[model samples]
Target: MIHTISALVKNRPGVLAEMAGRFGSSQVNIRSISCGETENPEVSRMVISVEADDDAVTAITSDMESLDVVIQVDDLGRKEFVDRELVLAKLTMDRETTTQLMQIFEVFRAHVVGMGQETITVELSGDQERVDGFIQMVAPFGIRSLCRSGRIALKRGDD
Candidate 1:
C-alpha cells in the first residue's frame, strides 16, 4: 500500500538529510517526497510517500517521529487529502499533427508552454493517474523527453 507521511520539522540545515538517513535505516523506500516552508518560517512541512506493508509503515513513522528535528508526524494515507503531480512533455509534431496535439492538450487540460517548428512542449498538472493517461495518449506521437514532479499532497479540511 502507498502511505503518505507528513512531518513538521525545524527549518535547519541537514534536516532533510538526517530524515532521509532515518528512513533508509528503517528500510523504507520513499516513492515521493516534497518539502516547503510553512506559515511559520521556522518550520517546514515534509511530505513523503512510500509503498510498504502496514507494519513497515508503522515502524518508519515511529522512527521519523523520534527525530530531533521533527516536531510532529501525521499519517495522511488514511485521511482526506488532495494529491497532484506535474509533468512536462516534449513531443515531436508536424503541422498536420499539431492540431490533433492541441486538441489532446485541451482535453487533458494541459497547456502548450512552448513550441518549435517540429516540437511542442506541454505542461500538465493533475493526479498521477491523469498525468499517466495523458502520456499514454500522446505516446503515439514521438515523445522527445518528459519530466514529472512526484506526488505532493495536502489535507482537505481545516483540521
Candidate 2:
C-alpha cells in the first residue's frame, strides 16, 4: 500500500538530508517527498509517500518519530486527505494541431502556459490519477520536456 506520512520538523539546513538519511538507514524507500514552510516560520512540514507493508509502515513511522529534528509525525494514508501534484509539459506542435491540442487541454482542464513557434508548454495541477491521464492523452503530441512536483497532501477537515 502507498502511505502518506507528514512530518513537522525544525526548519534548518541539513534537516531534509537528516530525515532522508533516517529513512534510508531504516530501509524505507520514499516514493516522493516535499517540504515547505508552514504557518510557524521555525518549522517545516514534510509530506512523504512510500509503498510498504504494514510492518514496514510501522517501522518507518517509528524511525521518523525518533529523529530529534522531527517534532511530530502523522500517517495520513488511512485518513481523509487532499493531495495534488503539478506537472509541466512542453510539447512539439504544428499549426494544424493547435486547435485540436487546445481542445484536449480544455477537456483535461489544463492550460497553455507558454507558446513558442513549434512548442507549447502546458501546466496542470491535480491528483495523481488526473495528472497521469493528461500525460497519456498528450503523449501523441510529442512531448519534449516534462517536470513534476512531488505530491503534497493535507488531512481533510478542520483541525
Candidate 3:
C-alpha cells in the first residue's frame, strides 16, 4: 500500500541523506518528497510518499520514529486526507501569447508569479491530478522545469 509520512526532524547536515538511504535500503519506493525548515531553525519537516508492504512500512516508520533527530511521524492515508501540490513553470511566450494564456490560467485559478515579454512563471496549487492536468494542457508551449510538493494530510475536525 501507499502511505504518506510526515516527519519532523532536527535540521542538520546528512540527516536527509540518511533518512533517504534508509528508505532505499529497505526497498521502499519513495514517490515524492517535500520539506521545509520549521519555525525552529534547528528543525525541518518532510512529507514523503512511499509504496511498501505492511511489514516494510512498519519497519521504516519505527526506525524513523526512533531517530534521534525525528520529532514526529504521521501516516496520511489516501482516502481520508487532503492532498496538495504546487507547480511552477517558466514559460516563454510573446506579448500576444501571454494575454491568451492569462485567460486560460484564470479558468484554473492559477496566476503568473512573474513574467516578461518572452517568458512567464506561473504558480498553481491544487490536488495532484489537477496540477498534472494543468501541466498536460500547457506542455505544448514549453516547460523550463517542474517542481512538486507531496501530499500532506491532516486528521479531520476538532482534535
Candidate 4:
C-alpha cells in the first residue's frame, strides 16, 4: 500500500532533511515528496508518499508527529483528498508529426511551453493516471526528456 502523508512544518532550512531522516530511520520507502510554502509564509506543506504497510505507515506518521518542526501531520491516504502532479516533456517534433502531436496535446489538455528546432516541450498537470496516460500518448513521438513534480494533495471539506 502507498500512504500519502501531509505534514505542515516550519518553513526553515533542514526541515526537509529532518523529515527524510525520520522516514529513513523508520525503514519507510518514500515514493515521492513534494514540499512548498503555504499561504502562511512561516509554514510549508509537505506531501510525502511512501510505499508501506499499515504498521509502517502508523510508525512513520507517529515519528513525524513527534518532530518539533512538524506543526501538523495527516494521513491523507486515509481521507478524501485531491492530488495532482505536473509533468513537462520534450518530444521530438517534425512537420509530419506536428499536427498529430498538437491533436494529442489537445486531447490531454497539455499546452506547449517551449519549441525548439526539432523538439516541442509540453506541460501537463493532473492526477497520476492522467499524467501516465499523457506520457503514454506522447512517448511514441520520441521523448527527448521529461520531468515530473512529485504528488501534492489536500484533504477535502473544511478541516
Candidate 5:
C-alpha cells in the first residue's frame, strides 16, 4: 500500500535533511516528496508518499512526530484529501499532426505553453490518473521531453 504523509515542520536549515535521514533510518522508501513554505513563513509543509504496510506507516508517523523540527504529522492516505500533480511535455509536432495534437490537448484540457519549429510544449495539472492519461495520449506523437511534479495533497474539511 502507498501512504501519503503530510508533515508541517519548522522552516529552518537542515530540517529536510534531518527528516530524510530519519526516514532512511526507518527503512521507509519515499516514493515522492514535495515540500515548500506554508502561509506562515516560519513553517513548511511536506507531502510524502511511501510504499509501506499499515504497520510500517504507523511506525513512520510516530517516528516523524518524535522529531523536534516536526510540528505536526498526519496520515493523509486514510483521510479525505485532494491531491494533484503537474506534467509538462514537449512533443514533436508537424502540420499533419498539429490538428490531431490540438484535439488531444483540448480533450485533456492541456494548454500550449510554448511552440518551437518542430515541437510544442504543453502543461497539464490534475489527479494522477488524468495526468497519466494525458501522457499516454501524447506519447504516440513522439515526446521530446517531459517533467512531472510529485504528488501534493491537503486534507478536506476544516481541520
Candidate 6:
C-alpha cells in the first residue's frame, strides 16, 4: 500500500537528506515528494509518499518521530484528501503548431512562460493524472525538457 507522510523538520543542513536516507534504508520506496516553507525559517514541511506494509508504516513513522529534526508526522492515508502536482515543460514551437497548442493549453490552464527561437516553456499545474495526461497530449510536439513537482495533498472539506 502507499502511505503519504507529512513531516515537520527543522530546516538545517542535511536534514532532508537524513530523512530520505532513513526511508531508503528501511526499504521504503519513495514515489513522490513536496515541501512547504513554514513561518519559522528553521522549520519546514515535507510530504513524502512511500510504499510499505502496515508494520513497516508504523516502524518508519516511529523512527521518523525520534529524529531531532522531525517535530511532527501526519499520516495521509488512502483517503480524504485532494492531491495535485505541477509540471513545467520546454517544447518545440512553430507558427502552425503554436496556435493549436495554445488552445489546448487554455483548456488545461497552462501558460506559455517563454519563447525562444525554437522552443517555448509552458507551466501546468493540476492533479497528478491530469498533469500526466497533459504530458502525453503534448508529446507529439517534441519535449525539450521538463520538471515535475510531486503530489501535494490537503484534507478534503465540506464546501
Q: List CA RMSD, all candidates.
A: 1.4, 1.1, 2.4, 0.8, 1.1, 2.3
Off by over 4 Å in 5: none
lDDT, candidate 1, 1-159, per-residue tens? 989888999999999888877778888788888888999999999888888888888887898788788999888988899989999999999978888988999999999889888899999999988999999999999999999887888889998
lDDT for model 3, on a 0 to 1 scale?
0.80
Which residue pairs does candidate 6 place in steric collision? none
lDDT of 5 by residue, 1-159 (tens): 989899999999998888877778888898888899999999999989898899988988898898889999999988999999999999999999999999999999999999999999999999989999999999999999999988999999999
Candidates in order, TM-scores: namely 0.92, 0.95, 0.82, 0.97, 0.95, 0.89
Ordering by TM-score: 4, 5, 2, 1, 6, 3
Give the top-scoring candidate (TM-score): 4
**Cand. 4 TM to true fold:** 0.97
TM-score of 2: 0.95
TM-score head-to-head 5 vs 6, winner: 5
Q: Write the per-residue lDDT of candidate 4 for residues 13-102, one digit (tens) a residue.
A: 999999998889888888899999999999999999899998988988888888889899999988999999999999999999999999
Output the better candidate (1/3) by lDDT: 1
Give the range of the ten consecutive residues with the poorest summed lDDT in model 2.
19-28
Residue-level error in angstroms, candidate 3, position 77: 1.2
The sequence of per-residue lDDT tens digits that candidate 6 reaches over residues 22-72 is: 889998899987777788887888888888898888898899999888998
**Global fold similarity of model 6 (TM-score):** 0.89
**Which candidate has the top score in lDDT?**
4
Q: What is the lDDT of residue 65 in candidate 3?
A: 94
lDDT of residue 128 for candidate 4: 93
Q: How close to the true structure is residue 132 of candidate 5, measured as C-alpha lDDT?
A: 91
The candidate 3 region of ten consecutive residues with least summed lDDT is: 150-159
